[model samples]
Target: MTEREHSTVVGQLPRTDVSSPLTPAMLTRLVWALWMASLGLLAVGATWTGPGVAVDGLTVLMWVVVTFFSGIVHSYSRRYMAGSDHLGRFFYRLFAFTLVVMTLVAADHVALFALAWLGMGLVMADLIGIVRGWPQARAAGALARRYFVASGALLGAVLALLAWATGETTISGIGAQADALSIPVWAVAVGGLILVAMAQSALLPFHAWLLSSMTAPTPASALMHAGFVNAGGILLLRFAPLVTLDAMAMQILVVVGAISALGGKLLKTVQTDIKRQLGCSTVGQMGFMIMQAGLGFFGAAITHLILHGFFKAYQFLSVGDEIERTQPTTDHESSSMGVAGAVTTGLTALAGGAVFVALTDKGTHFGSGLVLVALVVLTTLHAVRSVVGAASVPAAVRFVAVPLVAVTAIAGYGLAYRAVDVALADLPVVTAPADLTIVHGLVLAAFLAAYLAIERGVYERSEWLYVTLLNATQPDPETLLTSQEEYNEY
Candidate 1:
């Protein structure tokens, strides 16, 4: 061999390392097969039940379509497909559309119940599989994925056994013997499945796995966070009538949703990474969905799910655009707000929260008085901030608006002599006129604060919360299809 050629060969050898074989085609086929099987099951389910024919048919159809979309996602596991971000986006919308269909069809007891058990278990397992096999997935993430798969599989098997033991493979007739059996068998199945699904959805306490799952690819993150993650809540909406059976469970869902929404918003305030912020926001939003389910606001929850899925998908897709723009650049983190603006916002938030807390147990006189005081302070500070910061808008403003309105309305209602139930219809009027006035004023102030935050290059606290909501249960984008040397296949 020539000396120069030998030298070149030796130099190249140190730069290369062996890697796990690329098996995108295999992954694609598996996902495709699973999608087809889910559709087949839906078809079987539709025909197996003789009654509620229309409901069953629609439910089956929706499930089939969603599964197909999920399969398409898996199909794009190939390296060549990774280059086409648009294909990834199309799958995202399909997944979202599936959620919308499921939400609408789940209103039927049988369909809701069947989907809760069979469909949720399958979907969770699918997500776990994809996350586990991701080429660059972390050890902890892979372990978490396996745990989800095991748990989901175990749950599915248990339900299947329960159905068998009762001599009822279909959800329509399993509980027909007992007095309580007057409730459709679907309700029992749906209830059981919804509980498990909520845990998988990461409503609050079961939320750690969701944050960890963020280490996955961005397309995976987009689909899961924007659409797939909400599958549990949608499942719950299907069995809305049954969720009321156990009052404690209903209350728990409500409280979890409340905590997730409020606490998640607070935490999002501090996150530095883009993905983590969105993940936390997702946790909060799902909490809202759960709360709606608890309140028997099935319709509202479904609507929220649809709107959120669309917007969040758009937001995640934009992340890829941001990545491409930033890739060739250096650090560009914006500076924090000036001291005065920060202090004003902090004090306003504290006062708002304090008033709401203080009034929860108090009578009309004290509650109204406190609410009025808090509202005035909040409004004044908000105005001051807006007037001063009209020239330096931040990019995060758009994301934060949704949560700000929600929190403001919640806090406003809490501080008044009114109950702040999530079911929009159930929200009562304020007995105290002062409290009502304060609520109106606070709403205006919230809008002002949001505007000011945007103008001052400051991310509104709610925007941060939204980011957390998006982050909490969503996947990270960078790990999805990067060409960076550090992430490149060997």
Candidate 2:
């Protein structure tokens, strides 16, 4: 068969017919209803506070985000996977994973939370390898299963340690007694939680699973990237009290986050596949979220995750369009700005920074807040430059559009930050800004140097550096397909 014919056959359902009452289309509507209900609950300020189950601002926010993304993925999958095999099983597992994540966020009891966390990983692994005949899909699922199991084990150990030390079975109870815990106990617990976060978020060494998971269907990838990967930041935010106990632990988070962010970004530049590039991008974005938590702004971390979830979900769902758009472009187009364009970009960035500070009240204080503000400003600068340097646009139009877009984008971010900050105000250690240290300066310097190197194409010139990054970004060989013949079920 021709390549096109083979792909068509691979996408076809098995010859043996299977029936189910609950179709993917039905599930899509149900998920959308649930999403709407979550929004209504948030609107009415409904909450439940208890020992075994609790629903507060964080829970409500996550509920809305989770259900919304789940709804979108389900809706997309209905058409995307129409002729594929085991359509019913796929939706079932997807819905189960969504519920598991929702339960995890609302769980107050240590056992319940742990079980939900484990369930999430298991269901996601199942979804990753839903096509039973595909060797690549099975391998990807197995690889991811290992990482998820390791993450769950670490989280379980930490939760057990905290319960043993505090004599509390509930998360709130443990937090209330966090201050009384000894240094050694605090150190071990914080260390374990960080490891759990790292694995779940696919940071650095743990990122291979995500890169190899492209064998899964697009909807599964969308849900995994949009909702599942954000679990690390959610984990850290939920345990903010315990994490903030050790200043040294917080500093360690900063260092680790910086490394992961820079490493992920560098790896993304070398990836030729769209899905792997997105996986690397998630690692970098998660690093920034963790860094926000380390800076004692858990609220900001929450904001970052929510926004990232929406953005990534859309990106994944629109992958077809992305492929079509990029297929015709073989050469890289360099963007440049004249003196007027440069001036416009600089002024727009400054205006964006001012708006951000005015709305969020950041950068006024010393410490990591200043660093966060600078990063935001730099992001604005990059965005404005992209707009102003567009070769097809008229200079007058580019200059006119730069400030408007920058201010609007920054203003939206500021609003989101404020909303999240307000929602999490009642939570302990949610916005505790840490004092600046020499260690932070060193990390910042290293990040800046790496950023400059990438922007200047230093890695492209250095064969060793290019090779290192290429190897670092590659998926596991076991999860790769050598040919269409190897992809038994596509």
Query: How well does each candidate superpose onto the true structure, as a TM-score?
Result: 0.50, 0.93
TM-score of 1: 0.50
Question: What local lDDT score does residue 361 receive in model 2, on the 0 to 100 scale?
Answer: 89
Worst 10-residue lDDT window, candidate 2: 1-10
| lDDT for each candidate structure | 0.49, 0.85
Off by over 4 Å in 1: 1-80, 83-141, 150-169, 174-195, 323-486
**Candidate 1 lDDT tens digits, 1-490:** 2122222111122112322233344545655675676577654553333333324443454455455545544543333234432333333433444454454443323434444444543443344334333454544355455545654564455456545556544333433422243345544554566556566566666666666665555656666676666666655543343455555555555556666755555446556667767777787678666655654445435545655665666566456433322234575544454664465455555555565556554323543334333533454354444433333455244224422543475365453323222222221111111222343344335545644554554545456655754454444342344556744542
Query: Candidate 2 lDDT, tens digit per residue, 296-319?
Result: 888888999999999999998877
Local error of candidate 2 at 372, Å?
Answer: 0.9
